[model samples]
Target: MKTSVILNQENLGSVLSNVKAPTYDRDKVTTSIVHIGVGNFHRSHEAYYTNELMEHFGVLDCGICGIGLLDYDRKIYNILKDQDGLYTLMIKELDGTYTAKVIGSIVEFIFAPENPFAVIEKIAHPDIKIVSLTITEGGYNLNEATGKFDFSNPVIIEDMKNPMSPKSVFGYLTQALKLRMERGVGGITIQSCDNIQGNGDVAKKALTNYVKEAAPELLSWIEENVSFPNAMVDRITPVTVAADKEILKEEFLIEDQWPVVCEPFIQWVIEDDFKAGRPAWEKVGAQFVENVVPFENMKLRLLNAGHSLLGMLGALHGYNTIDEAANDPDFEQFLKDFMDVEVTPTLGDLGDINLDKYKKSLIDRFQNIYIKDLISRICLESSAKIPIFLLPTLKQQLRNDGEITRAAFVVAAWCKYNDGVDENGNTYEIKDAMSDTLIRAAALSHKDPIAFLKIEAVFGELVNNKRFVETFTNTLNMLRINSVKLCVQKINSSSTSV
Candidate 1:
């Protein structure tokens, strides 16, 4: 296996010995979707599904044309372009078996920052029916208090004035749609794959509010023609680090520049509300339903909320990976109780889901020894995760008069973790968008546990509520004084008894 054998269209036949190459003919495929912010999750999940559909159902028109918006996306574009948009998807199973396949669903890569006009032209093309996004939750420029587009965002301010030179995803979307309208192209569906509740609606409101002043008539046409379908996407794809490349080479003899490694499970539940049309994605294991709210509720409360519970705790206790944290008896039991008691009561009826079984399955997935998902990565963008993943359940729990001690504990541990010092005096650098303010608030929290909650941008009015304040104060004190391990054991002791 020589390194000279590059992974591209010319070498596809040669690499079939090690990598399960796509069976569909690449030349026949046509781009139907333009995916912005083509990151690891989009590759492992959506591209994987499109490949599956093309191979089995001969659906080649929905092939993805991946677009990179930010300057950092240049690295992805160059690497993927060199490989002809082909990459290996490695899946690790619990039984020590793994699968490797070279996915070729992404037929093209467009770097928007370098050439925004060409990218917009492609999106505005009549053939491209859907413009999807995997931009992170914060990428939407949402105001935390109102859950709407933040018009005050500097990028939004710039884009509104000069839509032609768009900087943000919203800019690209608006400019492309404007071109479509001018060119007499019919409507297109804008799908949001970010982990926000009612994601389609969120993107819809953001786009609707954004274009109102700039193009009022276009706004009217968009309101009538465009459709944003709410969707829930799930997968535990870890970041592809340097070591993963060596592993791929050793195990599969494939020298992929950026291969994605994930657990053996993946799911996408989407609302069937596309205005123009959509891929028969259900043919490839994607569920097209009338409403995705129940699935969203189940995932947000059970899986995402579970991560918020353990990510900071794992870092505080010096665990490196999610499995290490979940494998611990104390942390494992705490998650069970947290889900069964605190989180489950906040969820609506999730039809056909045995929640107890689902909870156990989450434990299994989190404990997948082969995935090696980094807790530090999970802790990335903590300020954003707090509101999107945890606070919804907290607000609901307060309204329903449900148990919130565990939820409060999660927030408290996050605050303690932000202090940059663990119980053993070992130090860490605080990593967050509001690190300076959070660290200052965390320092004051030692004396005043309510200090962190006073930041209205993050905690809102929850600080004034006596119930939340008292609970959070007690948990913060416990995390600061005792070892995180002991505090977790104490919390589990009560949970396990119940």
Candidate 2:
């Protein structure tokens, strides 16, 4: 097969020119990993890392075959197809180190909406070793309150009724795995790159449940053969805007269909449990750990938690991006105190990365002006994010009966944001799907204060935990009186007062 796009080696050099190579041509690449949801994050982080694997380490068996589980992903598939599966990843560094590297890790791109059977066939291909995902937290079709598969969801029902027309990613993955087992293809690693607790395990459970309900044989087979490796992936990647496109055009001198812009900081820690042969990803700077729980806790509690706090606070304070939030002295101090006092105590010591270093990196990443990670992007799905990022610390504080003033501040801020208005009294569109439900819930809670605590979907059964409920009620009352800003000030004053 002929290559689609040509890059001039003379002008851009051999190192720079091979970014747009076609994957279907067997001569140019070897397919080892299949990645679902080839969005900006996967393109910038995973694909860039793989490109480095080929360039620096000389390990050439890894190439990504991109698969999309949604109709919206078709545009990205076409963009990558036109460029022969190459796109530039612009990594914005805080220390004045800017890089624009074209990555060619993905050789073939297919959209499940238009080509569902093709995706299933590709998954059952003998040579494909790793099946990875970057589908967001909500993509797994999990219940926000229960942290498990919501079998009652309409999509789940559709998938159960029509397995061949599998709508959700979870259903499609199960169907594909069934094909692999039936066709006698060996086991493959199911690696999840989403930012959820036990992400890989969650993926395993969801896929397993779907198989068990729809096809018991596949579930049994997966339990015996498939290996789901838990991982922690971190990088601040924002949705690409028109101005971002203009920046890419000026910097790289090429028009990319879906260019990714991200902060320089990126980390991937995986549990070494692949059943099949895998890529030497460590050669490309991936970390393999015996247990990833400590690392996961640190990232989830401090970094992820702080990001959520800052995002809501920033939006309330009339800021667009994280850098703007970092610039506010009050917001910056609030974040520092929240991490230092409340979040740090909850984190039971990470191996090499202690609380100090982790806290510093959180502030530094937030302060990186070049990345422009929008506060609005992080503000979505507070109902989902609060449990993973904020609830753990809250639960821990309650157990210890420790001073949780700052933690209360975050809860109050979320409640305030849930009111669906900014500090300026200007109403912005609430971007969450549960906006109407949450708004009514919060308003009703304001009527009786403790009444809102009854909504277990958002608060979970933890609302009955007396210590947590007491601190939370006090903090919410303070917020309503002095506003979120003053509530944060009081908490920081009491928690970290020197």
Candidate 3:
């Protein structure tokens, strides 16, 4: 596996000859953004956009400085740091073509766990104008029941007691803001690239609440200064397995520890309300809008929620990949039916989108063979995802007195999948933040049929709603009685009335 083409700063000349490298010199780019939780999604989505911004329009100052906060991030931090914050990014276009580039947008990376003090100082630095996050949906530390920051959580409680020495993101953010206040640096936007609806509001609420009790003065300062802009970020980036690493080594002769592979399609709709300055992302196809809600809703409900629908039902049908599931006639019809009948009716406020065309695009995205997006990856954190991506659809449908049979079926499939077994008795491990509780409830639901809904953290008010309960129970019973294909047909046919 040894190769002459090592992926480092010095090999830029050689790497450029093999594949695309940054057109702008690496030394010219300055860091203006400090992104927390710099995972693969961030690399392929936000980082790629920033690189485009620089390459296309010479917007070099907005380069990102990636920071790793959790203990698990130590390994990634070292890997990226060793490579001098350089890595390969390969985008697989839907039509069988590909684009490969060494992304140099991330000018620096700090392993924050190694030195929290230094990390805080870096975040508070005047050059860092924006603080973004791709910390996943669960990383916000919000309590599922209240939808607010869970101060009662141990890490929050610890941070509340000892504000100087902290643990969670809230603590670090509060401390950084405090330092910024003392240093007289202007406010910076805290953008959330996570999958939450109104993520800006969620971030503001969580950060402000944490500081409100711990340091009221900081809360006041935050209220006057900070901005959390809601954003809708999309790109299908799967986990990089060993085979992906080998593709880089053998095909490109570039030995990179963490190279990102993703779909060519990318979109970022951000609200232009940065307290400090922001990048000219619009020059490179990013939309800086007045309201991101419509876009967020469209993407979350249609794209994300539809992905969840495909995921569990796909897993149950013995199809592992999204391509496999989305290609199947029955599953595709079921997907279109769910999106059109249950989801579209609730999404009237999406402006002028051709609903049918958008739905078709979604199916095409799902069926992209190169991405090979795992239904399991889409299925991860269902307890968190259901409420964020799917439950809103359920709530809206119930409010409008609309049909929710397929929507109910989607939730029921999740409950069945939570049992850790597919229809063929092929057991797969359940992975979720609420796995312990959800897995136990999934087992109990086989007998009780309503036990899964009782997990108030995930289900919220829907747990006690009689109408939803009855409909959900019917769907679960139908799954147990009939084959998955038959049920898909029922869902598509509208024969299984609510």
Q: Please provide, for model 1 over 21-120, each residue's C-alpha lDDT reduced to its tens digit, 9 standing for 90 to 100.
A: 8878999999999999899999888889889898889998898999998999999999999999999888887885668889999999999889989898
- Candidate 1: worst-modelled 10 consecutive residues by lDDT: 489-498
- Each candidate structure's TM-score, on Cα atoms with residue i matched to residue i, is 0.96, 0.92, 0.97
Q: Can you tell me which runs of candidate 1 are displaced by over 4 Å?
A: 1-4, 424-426, 495-498
User: What Cα-based lDDT does every candidate model obtain?
Assistant: 0.85, 0.77, 0.86
C-alpha RMSD between model 3 and the true structure: 1.7
Tens digits of per-residue lDDT, candidate 3, 1-498, equal 345477888877776365888878889888899999998999998898899888888888998988888889988898888888888997777885556788889989888767888778888999989999888888788877778777668888888888777778888898999999999998889999999999999888888887888888887788778999999989889888787778777777788899998987789999999999898888889999999998888899989988888898889988888888888899888888878888888877767767788788889999998888888898988878888999999899899988788888888889888878787888888889889999999899989999989888888789787788999999899998887788888767765555
lDDT score, residue 79, model 1? 91
Which model is ahead, 1 or 2, in terms of lDDT? 1
